[model samples]
Target chain A: MDERLLEILEDIQPEVDFETCTTLIDDHYLDSLSIISLVAELEEEFDITIPTVEIIPDNFNSAEKMWEMITRLSEED
Target chain B: MFSIVTYFSVEALLLLLVTALLYACLPQKLRRWVLLLASYIFFYSISGKLLAYLLFSTLSVHHIGLWLADVQNECAAQTKGLARDERKALNAVYQKKQRKIMGFACFIHIGLLVLLKYTPFFSENINTLLKLAGSSFKLQIPKYLIPIGISFYTLQAVAYLFDVYRKKIPADRNLMRLALFMSFFPQLMEGPICRYSDTAVALYDAPKMRYDNFVLGSQRILFGLMKKLVIADRLNLLIQNVYAEPNKYDGFIIALSAVGYTFQLYADFSGTMDLVIGAAQMFGITLPENFKRPFFSATISEFWKRWHITLGTWFKDYIFFPVSMSKPMKKLTTQARKKLGNHYGPLIAGAVSLFCVWICNGLWHGAGWNYIFFGMYHFALILGGNIAEPVVIKITQKLHINRASFPYRCIQIARTFILVCFGELFFRAEGLKSGIKMFCKIFTDFTFASLKSGSLFKCGMDRQDYIIIIVSAILLFVIGILQEKGIQIRNSIAKKNIAVQFAVYYALILFIIIFGAYGAGYVPLDPIYAGF
Candidate 1:
């Protein structure tokens, strides 16, 4: 899941190193536009809805966090 | 019964001191009451009968929050143990109901703000249209005594309601907590636009005022005072003159005033934030910061993120993401991405939402065409940056430029500053037309004759005044650099001896007293953001 998530993130912003790097939002690696693209891709790839309420930095700051959120949200779904 | 014009005023300081004293002496339960009472007193002192508007907003937000919560609770109870399809059906029904309530809540809260703040602007536009249509009818524009902090607190009210509807936070049952959150005196005037999750519980807890907190809070307040009195107010002399009679000066002077107005705004607004956060700190409550050395930003979008940070977050959360992530926009993003590739795909929808954000951002500042133009100006800048990002990246890479290198970042920062100063020019201009004329004069009538003849000092700032402003600016810049580098000056000072702390405090006081723009011949700038 982490690998898949990294793929999606890199697809959205290839310049960023999604594995080791956190602070994606904090460091401006993934801005609002990136978030928009990432959200749409994550929903389609993972078959889970990404609600706006969960669009905070903590959830998308890293690939690991993104995977955690995806798994948790998928289970909830 | 006395009125206080700003947090910088002696009356406000006295009020804060007296309240802090009362809060410290009182029992824990009574401290919250003291805060509530002091908040009401501060509101009444400013707007008098208009306090009713704030009271009405508080009560309505409290009631609507609970109403939405009740629906959510009911939906949860019914949805339990149901089949997935049936549960989804019930959830949709409840969401629709809650959405209606949220819409109505926004109508009551944001509607009041629009009516009170924008009625005259709307009426004048309509009258112009009526005239343009060759009609004799003129709309009778009514004057409104707008409540103080209506703009700041209305956003708070709407944010609270939205949070409740979204289930980000449980609906706060205690009206007193909600009331305090809504009307917290320090932030009620000009906000960092705090969230319920940020300060509500901390305020209700009303921690005992420790000596360190008191001293630290006082130090912060004094720092804010220096920023306001020494810099923002001093710059006011030039800014007010150039902006008022923009036609009186050449573009060089106009450009200087634009830069002056931008710095004045920063000092004024950020200084007020310092006072607000400091006052909250005295009560052992912390408010979110509204600024992060915005001038250091390398892009207009980055500038917005760093400046008036809370308001930007509010628009991002409430306006930007919601609009962009809406069903149609999401679908637009999905479809566009497949066709246009990753970056430009989401940008189409992002631009749509960005436009909405900037329009609200502009009008949220005030109800004027210039404010709208200010919003659109940034919107265009941000959107243009977005469009040019790929090209810039390609060019920089081809040119062997390290985008993250110091010299390149410096150029970016300088470029962003010039753009921001122009935006502030429009923001501070009398109206849209004046802003445009001043902007045009920058190119058409550009010259340094005023500086060559030494007549530049005569407008409102003198040679001595210019020197003082320059020295103060350098001081602020050093402090900003330390802060950006993660040096906590206050905390570092706190670790020092008591004598050192007091010396720092007294130096700030004496600085304001000596070079401050208060005595005769200096008309202090009014609280700029408070009007917004």
Candidate 2:
């Protein structure tokens, strides 16, 4: 819902486009290593430390999914 | 000769039965010792006097490591809370002691390795030098039979010393456990190259066997057998014939043989890794994964990460990173960037690491010139990739091409295959000159007509055999694709009903029995990585 989050999603869409990338897992766009790198980048940019378990495929599937997960993690903190 | 008989078919069966019995009946503390004894027996059976050499090298390293650890502990205690001058003096003493110990360990292990593996090469060079010096003496290089797994164990021993030096893990105090870890029968001959920190705990504190571990490990063994007997051995025929006479074949045929060798190497090496790791798993021990669908890797660096992972990681940790991160290389890169630009820093570092990794890889494979060129070939490709990364990104941006798109990925995959094929051509070549000749002939005499005329089949394979090879390769690729897509094949099988499980097991065993390239008339091919 936030414009800043939307901008981040747009930036990642090309590399992590699950809708168009059938070669990847159905829900998650990035592989294990890619997800780790993405999380590091996001933490630096968004100023939030994503919990280790929250980095799994189920929660970080799409832009909307990642936003929901991040919002919850931040709220919990 | 007696040892040879112990390794024969019936003996192997008996050994397996005995091992199973021991696993069932032996007390927890005694099982490891029994396994260690059995491992030595297996080695002695094959290696004879060479077994003594292995034992000597293992024991020497074990004692030296223990001694070094004690010295380091003493130095650390003396230096604690000391003034800067006193601390510096203590640290210098510690460094000197560490260096002396490490140097002796390295000399003994590397000296043994060079003597066993490179004596012939060294002897020839020495003779040539003698002749140049006008010596009247004519010396012949004596043939020495290398002990089985000498190279593997030597590398493991060296890694153990390095680990101790770094204080990553304390030097293992138990000599038997150290010996067992180094010479564990199943992995000793051809290793995934076990590290002290990674496999030490498992070898020392083996957990009680669970039903799940047994079932999964069994499945892994079956898969390994399928890959080895059904695919690699079959491909060996074609590779050997083509490489034996590279002059006879055109580039296309040579290229095909190279591709065949790649598949054969992967199947043979990874298959054995599965068998070794799986065997360890049966004792509820988890070994480091050796392969992760290597061919699916999009980049050369990625391929190294996925293929023979332990070996790659070893070289990276012990060789490449150290060389690349050395003060001299770092200063050179920093100076170059300040003078020239940041673009060249990565380029220089990449080149250094690639060169180190490749040369080591080639030498690790063998002392052969072909192996060296194989290493150089990959070094060039990986270095080229690193250099072109920025340019590629720039070009794609300018062209408005989505680089991560499926079509783009396909192109990268195809390019990777071509790169791999070229490397294998050199790797499978009989010698360096043959590799060059075969590579040159590929461009000059390439023709599609050879395929039509059945020249491909002329390489000691029947039409039926070729058909089987193709089918099995397709099956392998299918399984690889499924795995790449994150399908857990073993878990999927586990979730299936019991009838299906039994059916799958039976099918695998039956296929191996009938279609496997072993038994009557078939020469048993040694595991490919065993020589290394």
Candidate 3:
């Protein structure tokens, strides 16, 4: 799950080092379109639905935050 | 009401000088009110009785903002000791009240915009429908006296309300600061819509004026004027002649106008931004920029990201994200993903949100069918791009072509440029039917003679005029290329000796005075986006 999150991050925006990166949206490394594509890719790979509300910067600003959200949501499912 | 066309008009120049002097003389704490007063005075000069609209926006946002904040505070206070589920219930109740306040405020602002700007268009369409149905009743189309900068101000107001509701920033307690954000005179004409969080601090801080800012601002204004006077205004003559009777012209002429209009629009809008941004800079405000040499974009999506950058950001924050996250959209995503594979699933929601965005974007420009078509056209291109991404990547990898190669990048830029030109053609055309006809003529009315027969020369410009335009355009293109490479030309030039600086300024001034298509018979176009 951790590797997958980093994979999506670096694949979409190569400059972002998910380990060190925070404020992805603030810096515009993850623009709205990139978010859309990321959501699609994540939903497919993890087989967990990431809805629009879950797409906010708080969840996706870092690989750790993203992993946390995905794990929690996976448990809910 | 002072149309920005009068950047050199005596009254405007005098007003600006007076405002600057007043700002400089005022004490630190009192300077904000000076700006607020200056904004209202400027608004009064242009909008007259319509100054009431600015006051109304200020008052409503001010009242509703406080109301939202109060509810939030009260909810927090009342729910502090409650059990978990009870606290959740209390928070939900507070959320509903906050939503109501936001909704009411949005309704008044958006309703005013729709009633003033769109009623006539909707009335005219309804009357057409009535006539088709053989009904004798026909509604009268209203001739609305739309306040200057209403669209821009309304959007700013909307952004502020959304931000407050989302708790992105605490709702501003000060009414005058909120008012100043909405009516900042420089941006009122055509906006790089200033969000409260983005610009309000700079505006209220009343930073001490620095000579560097003034010089840089003046240089930016000079570049802006050069673009407007030398290129956009000059091209206006040829565009008017070609578009007035487009069918009379051939394919090459229409194609030329398409390309010309694109250049003309960039020069006009970016010129306006430079002028306004420079004006803000003089006050040490550092307003956000609206353009970023969008022609260099390698994709339509990227072009939008660069062009009218604030509007794109505003929509993304206010419309696109909210819509994508709404319950119905989430459901649509799930269903689409299940039915069509995961690849296409999330795009379903994004597309639906983008659809709403483009439609609003089109309608926001004006109550015109062509503008609406322009919006949908872009929406189509962007959505098309999204769907084609994987296939493109696959093909590129299979062919072993470097996606980041220079030649490949140029091809993409050219392709996006042509697509944008076609979109701009519709945007600028007189009507939907005309835009369609003009587009059709591009394919049907072939003319190799337009290139060789010297017909292009006779349109509305002589040889000297064309030469001046070409030279100025080349200069702008070079600047654009350098800027794209992250070169700071203005800062670089500012480092040079006083003699070099004066020489550069003097040359631009001379070029503008000698060859600019204005001053005698030329009609200064109202800044194009001002109508919106």
Candidate 4:
């Protein structure tokens, strides 16, 4: 799951080093448009529904946070 | 009723003074109530008997907020010990029910807005259709007494309800706090449409106004007045002339009106925001900023992001994000990715969402065809920019051109400014047909004769007015540059000696008094966005 998450991040926004980067939203490395596209990509890859309420910065601000959210949601399934 | 800007009347100033004194003297717990009282007074001044609209909006949203919160709480309690899948199903049912509650509330509030604001426009269009069809019956267009700031406050109320539904902030149970949020006087006329979570705490806290808050707020208000009176109102005469009788002049004058109206709009709207935010600061009630230096934007999308920052964000949160992430758009994104490939696929959803936003943007400005065209104009520009992004990058790379060079960046800004000005032309035109005709004439009747003929001065202003406008505009531009660099002019000045600070403050007042376009012959134009 972690490896696949890294691949998704790389495919969506290749310029950023998702491994170490922590300020995806604050630094505007991920804009609102990019966030939408990223969410769509994540939903397709993981086969899990990510609702709008879960789209806040805390969940997607960094690769680590993204992994945590995915792990929790995948656990629910 | 007080004319705040018409003459910088003493009555309004006295009201502000008295309100400040009342707020300062009141107990901390009651200070928020003082603000609520002041809001009612201000609303009553403009709306008189029509204050019911505001009250109605407040009550409806408040009730809806409580209902949504209660439903969520009940469902949570019921599902706490249930089986996992069963709980999920139960939660889904409650969620659907809550959505209905939120949706119906939004529909009612927004429906009232549409009825009051757009009925005349709809009636007029229907009458035109009847005439075209050779019908004897024609619709009687009924005019409405639209309460001041309905457009702004309605959006604020709607946002508050949504915030409650989303559990962004628990449904604010205090009716008065919610009412104050809906009718905060400073932003009632125009807004940076604030959110409940961001502003409610400070608003309800009602902290005593610090010295810095008062001084900074006054300075900001004065700065806004200077922009409005010294530049925007001064230029209003010539622009009004060109727009009122667009076909009478040549292309140069029409084009000049377009550019002038654009600056006038920026100065007027941003000035109002400065004054609004500044006034709020005086009460230690923070409001969001509505603009950045939009002219510096290199692309249309960038321009929207910078200009009217709050409105754009509101639309993004309420319209764009929801539409883009909707189930249907997800399917569209999937299909587009499979057929059109990754590079252009996601933007299909983005574009459709953007299209809805622009349509709303156009209609939100007013119930006018030209405004719709203005919205579509930007939509086309932004979508075009998006689609051409990679191609432009490839071209720049192939040419080995330095895209970040000063000259190259200037070219981008200038192109974007021109595109913005052309849209504002349509936005400020008398009607859609007038805008189209004026646009056509700009190319066909392009001639240097208007400049040489000395017909420019004949529009309204003399050479002296022109000189004042140019110098003031230069000053504003320099200040904008400093601000863009993140320099706080007020703070820097505050660091100066008392004498220097006093002199600077007095000088700003004197400059505004002498140069402001309000006197025996001149009537200072109202802030343009105030109507919206």
**Top of the candidates by TM-score:** 1
CAPRI rating of model 1:
medium
For model 1, what is the C-alpha lDDT against the true structure? 0.92
TM-scores for the candidates: 0.97, 0.84, 0.91, 0.96
For residues B392-451, write the lDDT of model 1, one tens digit per residue. 999999999999999999999999999999999999998899999999999989899999
lDDT of 2 at B527: 62
Clashes of 1: 0
Model 3 interface DockQ? 0.20
How well does candidate 4 score on lDDT at residue B406? 83
lDDT of 1 at B434: 93
Q: Supply the TM-score for candidate 1.
A: 0.97
Worst 10 residues of 3 chain B by lDDT: B1-10
* DockQ each: 0.68, 0.04, 0.20, 0.45
Candidates sorted on lDDT, descending = 1, 4, 3, 2
Judged by lDDT against the true structure, how good is candidate 4? 0.85
Which candidate order results from sorting by DockQ in descending order?
Answer: 1, 4, 3, 2
lDDT of 2 by residue, B1-532 (tens): 3444322245653665577568657787887877788788878877777789888988888898898899889987888888866776677788788988888888888888887787786687688889999997766886778898887888889888887886766888898889888888777777778888777777766566667877888788888888888888877777877899888778888888888888888888888887777777777777889899888777887888898898887887677655655546555654554464444543575477668888878887888878888898888887787678779999999999998899998888878877888888887778889888988888888898877898777776778888888998889889999999999998788678999998999999998888888776666566667767
lDDT of 3 by residue, B285-388 (tens): 98888998898899998999899999998888788988886667666765675576545667888898999999999999999999999999999999999899
